[model samples]
Target: MRGTLLFDGRCGFCTRSRDLLARVDRHHRVETVPYQHPGTPDRYGLTEQQLARAVWWIDEAGTPRASAAEAANYALSAALGTTLPLRFYRLPGIRWLQEALYRWVSNNRQRLPGTTPWCEREPGTCG
Candidate 1:
């Protein structure tokens, strides 16, 4: 299934994850877009607040499909042809744990290694 993963470009952790995913996506099964790009939010029918909260995944038709860990796992599964982790992600308690961890990382990413001061700003406009 062809899909797109929209992510926070200004974020060091997210950008690094995007790059790693690109390598895993050898067959080009998914497209990765940075939400910081012009019109990205509008194109995906997402609000800035939504994009800021978590990564997003949309099918080729551009319908909003999932967010946070769900989106990341879907994109990874699509690219790597690995359904095992995807299955793990659906386990009720595991899903909760995954989302909580994802939120913590998202919330603390600016302080992560490789992060620049640009990502530390509110509404980080520069990357």
Candidate 2:
């Protein structure tokens, strides 16, 4: 059940979100790493800009999911002890909504709680 969870380490909002997820992720299925960490994207085969724009989850099958919302639904399903919801969340229409919501958050995260405009400039050192 081990997988990688990549996030924006510099954004306070992102860090806080990771921290909260960490607290509830008792199975340790999710391994948290900052996108800016050395070798992070290369190890996971994700692009730098994509990592900055959204959270990513690398499943055991080596498939990398790029949408933050889909990643979140997976994480939530993992935490919830169920996979039905996550499966549904991945349907084309739902995935589209997830991507849209994720983009909105990524675009406005600078103004979100625990985040600052500077966080966007320094993806690994802002918070």
Candidate 1: clashing pairs of residues: none
RMSD of 2: 4.1
lDDT string, candidate 2, 2-79, tens digits: 566778877778877877888878877777777777887787777788888888877767678645888877766665
Task: Please give the CA lDDT of all the candidate structures.
Answer: 0.83, 0.73
lDDT for model 1 comes to 0.83
Candidate 2 least-lDDT 10 residues: 118-127
Candidate 1: residue 47 lDDT (0-100): 93
Clashes of 2: 0
What TM-score, over all chains together, does every model reach?
Answer: 0.86, 0.77
For model 2, the stretches where C-alpha displacement exceeds 4 angstroms are 115-127
Q: Which candidate leads in TM-score?
A: 1
Worst 10 residues of 1 by lDDT: 115-124
| Over 4 Å off, model 1 | 115-127
